[model samples]
Target: MSDEYQTSGEYLHLLSEPAWQALRTPVALALRDAASDATLLDVGAGTGLGTEVLAAAVPDGDVVAVEPSPALRAVLLSRLAARPDLRRRVTVVAGDALGVDLPARLGAVLAMNMIGHLDPDGRRAFLRRVAERLAPGAPLVLNLQPPTEPTPVPFSVFGTVPVGHHTYEGGGSAEPSGPDAVTWRMRYRVLDADGTALREDHADYRWHVIPADALLTELTEAGLTGEVGPLDVVRAVRRT
Candidate 1:
């Protein structure tokens, strides 16, 4: 699988409002303690939804929104450009967080709904980088989804929303691709007022499942302590 959000990113933005509604509170709570003037990092910031949240969370801080997908970056940039306030506070960048050149010390890190993109080795490298660059007591917040081991996920409608004169639907299914990974098949559809399909797009991506224990152990090995919170969210803090 290409695993990049080439085509999917186009439609994913349409459903972001609902996702943001669910994410807003938890994400804010996670970053509530971050210093107001500290620099914040947002990894895999697709379409800038989480980036917007981060900007709101730290009004006085600079936010670095890192996205590796060009399609997603296009939308992210557009979003920033439209809001001069966010445009001033956010610096959009390309590539993985581990490879990007960031500040010597970070105030907080947000990696929402993107950790599965990294394999075990990549995860280790990312955590190590976070450990090295994150300011002492700064938090790295991310989530771990289900099927920690490779397993099949049933096809289900993830979202269905009605716009002006059309309805947009999106859903996905996943199949075991390896011992610790799954290949997700996503389907998106646009239906006219009469309920006829006007367009459809299909995409596939890979996700490497990480068990809670495995991730906590990795955090500890990287000199960070982590706590698993509600909704499978993990908040790890760099050691002093």
Candidate 2:
């Protein structure tokens, strides 16, 4: 199985419940006004949890659940089979959001918590692609964890010397330490920009830390205007 699919399948159970709840509220806020028969795209639809929410909201609309993982695709197919009503409204595609052919003229694009998986360049490219696919004013809902606060230390060290006890510092440490040490955990996903996963084992090979402001800047550079609220999730819009 492909690494993307494997990673998705492995986390499917964990996402089945919590993800549904976490994403439902935001997705609804973005798409509630959509026509009942609107066509929606769920990019990086891991196990179709978000897709299910979209499907539920627009019972008569069509939802394209795009996922790059082979294993998760099969699982999603099985889940669809169990619900014929939703099955008819949803189409499962084995593809990546960064470079997939979206159906012509979509009403909205739902990119839930998937942007963090991409590097800065890749994220920009994906945003541009999404903007291209969406209709005017279509919303791109992005959910991501914000960077941990940086600790500040108050100390004045003028000369850098190996041996020197100058004076007592009056400020605290500037960086979080101990159990609060902030580090981006390595996460794996299916498919790279070249359309190949590093390995079939779905091993995580890199760690990433996303600064909220930097990410927003990258999105703006891509022609999408949005804001990351204090809650840390970004909801950007593609203007007509």
Candidate 3:
């Protein structure tokens, strides 16, 4: 592992499992209804939680799982390697949303907690790529979390999250970095039954948040018709 992400990679895949557990089912349902049995793209698929959902929702469909982080992708591939059924339905790729080539005309695209990693221009470019690769009327589901309230607020997101057989102990802090950005730093420790810390990880990220209306306009310009849904969701359909 590279020094940049070595310390951060251990739990980068496990820490988010709790949140994804709640969101994955609904996402699978949405994608299944949108265009099941078609190629689906799981952008920034992380540890492949979303891909697992997609696999179950559309058993006959294929998923292009893309993640840029090597550590995360390693976890993702390992997970998939254990599931031959899912492996048959998924093709894992290590690339960002903008750089990766579309494997096929996508029936749907699920991007969760990913766009915030991009700047304004990068976001636009990514949307443009989605537009280009999307089949007409295909859905592009986005999980765009709202920024934490109030600038310069002291924020600590901490919890003991259970995954499969083990637990993860993690906490995070974030501060407003700019009018449209936040600097978030987090650390985690994977624990065993005996309270032994098996491995530790950390990450620092700067998220760029664009306003809802502005994002809608950008999506519209990118040939997607969309509306904001409950819980910070932006569901868009490729224009025919």
Find the candidate with the highest lDDT and give its number: 1
lDDT (tens digit, per residue) of candidate 1 on 114-147? 8998888989998998888887677888888877
Model 3 local distance difference test score:
0.77
Rank candidates by lDDT, best first.
1, 3, 2
Clashes of 3: 0
Per-candidate local distance difference test: 0.86, 0.61, 0.77
lDDT string, candidate 3, 1-240, tens digits: 233345666766656677776786557556645466468889988888877876666677878899888878888899999998888878988788888888567778989878888888899998988888777667788877756332453556556877766788877777888777887777787778877888877777788877788889999998888787756667888777
lDDT score of residue 183 within candidate 1:
97
TM-score per candidate, chains pooled: 0.95, 0.69, 0.85
Ranking by TM-score: 1, 3, 2
Give the poorly placed runs of model 2, Cα more than 4 Å off.
Answer: 4-8, 35-38, 146-208, 229-231
Residue 194 lDDT (model 3): 78
Candidate 3: RMSD to truth? 3.1
